[model samples]
Target: MWAAGNVSDVLAAVPQSAGAGNTAGGAINMDLILEDARRATEAREAASATPFDGTMEAEVSRRVLGTRAHGLEGPA
Candidate 1:
């Protein structure tokens, strides 16, 4: 038991069995961490973007363009 209660000790306490590994195994791998972060961000962005977003943008563009092509129009 460490009286200092260092961060390394706390990290080491975690089991590798979990998805996140502890520093007890070895040095931290920045590449893996960055890759994991990138994957998480991509997944989050994909989940946040609903299917209707694309359709809504396309519909608005079409209406605006259609109105512009017409002789006169106040609202699309």
Candidate 2:
């Protein structure tokens, strides 16, 4: 999972059932997963925007200070 600007991303892999007939019939589709991720991201962004102040200065500062205290880069 990842969050950027006004979007979040999610990628998941579902396995095929072995009892469905074939044991090696599992498949992976990036396009479908990407679309789902985009939708979910948009939904989250919309929800967040409803109450956001349109600025993340405080949050960014807190993260930076915390990182400095820990002697490491800010949380990613």
TM-score list, all predictions: 0.27, 0.31
lDDT of 2 by residue, 4-73 (tens): 2212212322332222213222222455678899999889888754434546655665666865544556
Index of the highest-lDDT prediction: 1
Name the regions of candidate 1 deviating beyond 4 angstroms.
1-28, 49-76
lDDT of 1 at 31: 56
Please list the C-alpha lDDT of all candidates, in the order they appear: 0.56, 0.49
* lDDT (10s digit) by residue, model 1, range 1-76: 2122244345543353332333323334565688899998888778866647887767877777775544465474
Residue 74 displacement (Å), model 1: 51
Candidate 2 TM-score to native: 0.31
